[model samples]
Target: MIVPPPLRFGVLGLGRAGVSMLPALRTHPHAVVAAAADLNPTARAQFTRDFEVPAYDSAEALCASPEVGVVYIATPHQFHAEHCLLAAANGKHIVVEKPLALTLADCDTIIDAVERAGVTLIVGHTASYNPTVGAARAIIRTGELGRLRLINFAAYTPFLYRPRRPEELDSASGGGILFNQTPHQVDASRLLGGGMLKSVRATAGVWDPGRRTEGACAALLQFDDGAAASLVYSGYDHFDSLEFRVSTEDERSLSLTSHGATRRALNEGARSPDEETAMLSAMGYGGPAMRSVGPGGMGMFQVELGLAIVSCERGDLRLVADGLIIYDDEGRRSLPLRYDRGVPGRGNVFDELRSAVVDGIRPIHDARWGKATLEACLAIQQSSKEDREVYLSHQVTVGD
Candidate 1:
């Protein structure tokens, strides 16, 4: 038996996503964040103080660091492509955030760069990475559920009301739930419901004139294998779907109940956008929210995404915070999924990256897969804009 040396990682853009990814990074036995880059001196200072590693203001500098074997891209949605190209150019393995890129061409460009550079690229941490979802997929693959028939996902949160950085409220700029959040629900559907999407009919609602973005959206996804997924998302924060968490409603979930608090803090607490942005930053790693960890040191990522149910021929799987609820001919059984907050024990985007870089395994969430997910999301928006059903021609099956 042989042991692989710990893989050191460099982080780009230490925002909420980057900071929040720390716990999951620590979960892997051979993975460690060795350095980071951020424009915010405050974030960099705090990161260096907490991790005791050199933090750089320039992303290139971090990528150039010899100590970093991999790059964890936690930057905003718009910067994903550029940063990925940079990391690939530096010959560093990459873990990029979801939605791959804003457009298919950008996604292709990124794909080309990484392939040419011969560096591994994994995009993820979506609901598809959820342990319960993994459990459901495993059961579905067993053919005990007959076949995947349908998927229903609903997400409602304070996403819109949260502090904005101008682009965060604009869809054209890759803001809103369309670009930022749909990848999770859509990818989950693709993962569990069979990945060959055929078409989608949808509508988007920008009810808040102040926000001027798609605060709400609903889409019906038709799959090639007769499976379908009905997805609805609302960021207005009026109602939270996490309330429907399966089994137990642990009161510890601030994400489940933070609608009012977010509104109050945004409207009354902050005097301007700068202040609100600062407030949001303060919730990232090394900030005030850093102190709040779950039973297994799960950070803010511990929040239950939403209520997701996958209907099969003989049974249905309900995804929850604790695990999954499986109802079949044998009656209902509760499957408690424990990944220790995305530790390396179970399969996920993190471990997938590790396996791809350390070993010779291909990640499920590769660039093409990400492009397929993005295709579905774009089809959803186009379907809404055209007021008709939009068909997807670029979708691929799980292994394809």
Candidate 2:
């Protein structure tokens, strides 16, 4: 067998997402972390020390580096477009973290840049790579479910209570559950609903005095085929749905007893940054770690924290950690899946991205698709503010 040359990656952020992605990139057969860039001196130093890769202070410098062939943009929501443009200009294939951009216009800007540069653009929406999600998509494609009807996704997390930078608490700058969490649900819905978003109606809440952004959101999405989706999310740092389901890959269950003990510790007094990190780590919430590998292999990390159910005319599909559970007139069945490194169906996000870049095959979650997902997410906020259903036709351009 012939082995292809690895795609060299220059990571643009060393933040939480960036750090978590490192293990997957390292384990990927056709990818390598060549270098990294971050504004924080400490993060830069740590990345360089750990990965033994050169580090830069600016994204522009990293993108311009000859050693880097693919630029991974894990920067904040606001910087996504700018970083993507920078990487495109440098002639690098791009992989951007989710919520592709804070707004539709920004997403377009990145899209235009990538199209102009003639490079591949892949959005890193990890939930889309979940084995269960993949199995659901496969089952839907088989037409076993008949006509897709509704997608209901719900998540609850102690998001804000976790470590955060200041901008993470601001809504305008793209902080909050809407921008951070809803993108996963929306992207999954769009993928299974056949990718044409029609409209959205949503409501958001700011129940916490300490956090300025929306801590919770509920949205209704309408697809062009008459399919509808319901999305409910909360990040107030209280109840965790993943804990409730005991579906985390780490095998750590978040029972009420543990939740109350942790909550009591936090309520006792304000925690320093170190204390917070320690607490989060103890709860099995930290950087990525490898799970499974070959056929039936799992990725290094799992961030999904709730449940997603897709209701079809002939059956109902529920997403679980290992795979999916389906219910129909014949009763219930479970389909298990695994990650097979670089192979298409058996692989994870990195594999899909690798195929897109190396083989010139456009992934379903490419830049344009990511932009559509972003539009749906923004509409959720707009609908909540305007007190009306927001139509998506005007949000997406004709060419896109």
Question: Which has the greatest lDDT?
Answer: 1
Error of 1 at 178 (Å): 0.3
Candidate 1 per-residue lDDT over residues 1-400, each given as its tens digit: 8888877889897777776577667666667879999988887898899889999999899999999989989888888999999999999998888879899999999989999999998887676876777788899999988988888888877788877787888899988888878788888889887688999999988998877989888889999888899998888878876566533445554455555666776788678768777777777666674443223543122232476788999988877666778998899988876665344212266677878888888778888889999999999899999999998987877782
TM values, all candidates:
0.93, 0.86
Q: What is the C-alpha lDDT of each candidate?
A: 0.80, 0.75
Q: On a 0 to 1 TM-score scale, where does candidate 2 land against the true structure?
A: 0.86
Query: What pairs collide in candidate 2?
Result: 158-237, 340-346
lDDT of 2 by residue, 214-273 (tens): 889999999888999998888765666665345453455334654434345655543554
In candidate 1, stretches whose alpha carbon ends up further than 4 angstroms from where it belongs are: 246-259, 288-305, 340-347
Q: By summed lDDT, which 10 consecutive residues of candidate 1 come out lowest?
A: 293-302
Clashing pairs in 1: none
